[model samples]
Target: MTATDDKTVVREYFNATGFDRWQRIYGDGEVNKVQLDIRKGHQQTVDTLMGWLEADGNLAGLSCCDAGCGVGSLTIPLAQAGAQVYASDISAKMVEEARQRAEVALEGKNLPTFEVKDLEELAGRYHTVICLDVLIHYPQDKVQGMISHLGSLAESRLIMSFAPKTLFYSALKKVGEFFPGPSKTTRAYLHREADIVKALEAEGWRIERRTLTKTQFYFSRMLEAVKDQ
Candidate 1:
């Protein structure tokens, strides 16, 4: 499907049942074994990224963008860390949830600007731009364009996470596609790490850090890239 087509599917899914399903998974709520594992894996990705940011310097006054921020999982922490965060998601419902959650999580602290926008529509330069777990919906061809767009908005850093394509995971994904579930409404795309790196390099960014988070059902490759100076 085209990027626009994928965006439609993603927006529709997230604006409806996708919001409910993810809110539960990202929250301290009851979930099945697979979901619980996914939650853990997702948290590990956030924590790892947070650690890397903290090591760079104090987050105070640092400008960042949480592209496709859902329920403010990373947005909340970034705000609490005193970063100036602008979080956006394709789904209005997800953006609303993220704003509400940020309000409660920040406790009168400054809230990040939340907007309903697709990745292509995102504008402005940030010290760091993060697009986490949001690229699974688009194929590699579309993802290359997305990487370039997002890279242009980051002055110094860009972080992204996607389902990594491997022989084992590719087979598993194909098998999973045969059985559709409530949360499987959108197409999930797996990307080769080398391909992603090449795309980033093409945009004048170089990978600085990389890690993989995996569980029984969840797998993501998290990468941090900085402008090649």
Candidate 2:
């Protein structure tokens, strides 16, 4: 698809009425279990990243950028940990909710800088750059370029997640496609581990750790890598 087509699809999905429904689902406390599971999954990935950061003693005063930061899930925690954070999302509503959530979670602490912008508009280098559940919206042909761009925004580390590629996983994804619900982006692209590695390697990033999680709705693979400096 052309760039315009890509943007249109993204805009439609994020701006659609379905997203409003999703925001309510995500923001409601009635579904605490679902939220907890989601948090647990993200925390697992964050723990792995923290371990990597600790390996190098000179990593303090680090700045982190959370591209596609939704509802401040990882963003607020990172900010609470005293890291300078810059978070951005393509959806205006998502950014607004994230800002509100951050205000409450970071009431007595410094807040991360939040904005509504696409990954391509991101500027400045951070010690760590995270793009989670964001790349799935991009077409297969554009993933490598997107990865390279994210890598450039990081001075030391980059962590990203993608839907895994497997027969079982693909079948499950197809089922999800059938039961369409409100999400910022509707189109999902599953990536093979080998292909994901190749894309990062092409941008001179070396994978340091990988983790896979299988949930009822999705199978996610997260990777932590270091940019070749």
Candidate 3:
């Protein structure tokens, strides 16, 4: 599918059923075993990313863009940690939900600016750009352009996560196709790590840190990339 076509599908899904499903997974709520596992796995990724960010020193006054800041999961924490955060997502519902959550979490304090924006529409430079678990929506053919666009917007670092393509994971994903669930509603694309690294290198970035989070139902390869000096 074309980039526009891909964006439309993502916006539609997250604005509807995807919003509800992820809200539950990211929230402190009752969920099925699979979803609970997914929640744990996602939190691990977020924690790993936070560690990498904080290790660079104080987040105070740092500018950040949470490229797919679904429901303020990372946005709220970053704001609380004193980062100037601008968060965006393709789903209006997700953005609205994140805004509401941020309002409550920040208690009228430092709150992130939230926008409903497709990744391609994002502009301006930031100290760091984070796009987590969002790349699963993009196929290999379109990944390079997206990576370059994101890289251009980050003055210092770009952190991203994607479903890893491998024989084991690919087999698992194929098996998942047989089960009836939300997984069937929209296409999920897995990407090779080497391809991701190549894309980052092409944009003049180098991997600084990396981690893999996996569970029975969730998998993500998260990495931090720094601008090559």
Candidate 1 — which residues are off by over 4 angstroms? 177-180
Candidate 1 residue pairs in backbone clash:
none
Q: Model 1: per-residue lDDT, tens digit, 6-33?
A: 8788899898988888888899989977
What is the C-alpha local distance difference test score of candidate 3?
0.88
lDDT of 2: 0.75
RMSD to the true structure for each prediction, in A, is 1.6, 3.0, 1.6
- Lowest lDDT 10-residue stretch of candidate 1: 175-184
Candidate 3 on 1-229: residue-level lDDT in tens? 6777877877888888888988888999999887788889888888888887788786988999999999888998899889999999989999999999999999989889899898999999998999999898898999999999999899989999999999998988898831226543667899999999999998889898998998777889998999755
- How much lDDT does each candidate structure score? 0.89, 0.75, 0.88
- Report lDDT (Cα) of residue 134, candidate 3: 88
Q: Against the correct fold, how does model 1 do in TM-score?
A: 0.96
Q: Evaluate residue 118 in candidate 1 and report its C-alpha lDDT on the 0 to 100 scale.
A: 89
Q: What's each prediction's TM-score?
A: 0.96, 0.85, 0.96
Q: Mark the 10 consecutive residues where model 3 has the least summed lDDT.
A: 177-186
Model 2 stretches astray by more than 4 angstroms: 1-3, 16-18, 32-60, 177-185
Q: Tens-digit lDDT track for model 2 on 94-194?
A: 88888999999889577899988988888898889999877777777888888989888888888998877788777866776422444434567788889
